[model samples]
Target: MDLGGNRRGVDMGPYAVRASGLYGMLKDLGHSVTDGGNIPVPVPEEIGVGA
Candidate 1:
């Protein structure tokens, strides 16, 4: 989460990491990679200010 930051699109970090072949790279190194998938988070519109 962006926390108190005013930046938008910071949430896209996860997507960028996955697109960078992180899982594939780990597996190639003999590491087990299991994707638990993204956790469900409410969008900004679904949350009220100060909530």
Candidate 2:
């Protein structure tokens, strides 16, 4: 979710976390996994000056 810095694919954070098996692990531990889905993100061009 970081911007204005290194372009190391920070936008893929959610995918990476999911791919890490976190949800599966939690479910294996008998916990319910509720995926709230991705957050709303503004494209870089949508940022205003000094924002």
Candidate 3:
């Protein structure tokens, strides 16, 4: 949901959280970990962010 702003790399927040072992940590605590996967975001060119 981070689009059209001064925040670069904010779009990678989900990936970063997943890479930080969020699923593993949750599973370790005896919780079901079902990854829904990343949401699709439009490219800059697609939405004309800075172009």
> Model-by-model lDDT, in order?
0.84, 0.84, 0.81
Off by over 4 Å in 2: 3-12, 44-51
lDDT of 3 by residue, 1-51 (tens): 576768888878878878899889999999998888877877766776555
How well does candidate 2 score on lDDT at residue 37? 87
Residue 19, model 3: Cα distance from true site in angstroms: 1.2
Stronger candidate by TM-score (1 vs 3): 1
For model 2, name the residue pairs that clash: none
TM-score of each: 0.56, 0.50, 0.52
Q: Candidate 3, which ten residues in sequence have the lowest lDDT sum?
A: 42-51
Worst 10 residues of 2 by lDDT: 1-10
Candidate 2 lDDT over 1-51, as tens digits, reads: 666758788878779879999989999999999878888868879899899
The residue pairs found clashing in candidate 1 are none
Q: How much RMSD separates candidate 1 from the native structure?
A: 3.7
The 10-residue segment with the lowest total lDDT in model 1: 1-10
Q: Report the Cα lDDT for candidate 3.
A: 0.81
Off by over 4 Å in 1: 1-9, 43-51
Model 2 Cα displacement at 37 (Å)?
Answer: 1.5
Pairs with backbone N, CA or C atoms under 3 Å apart (clashes), candidate 3: none
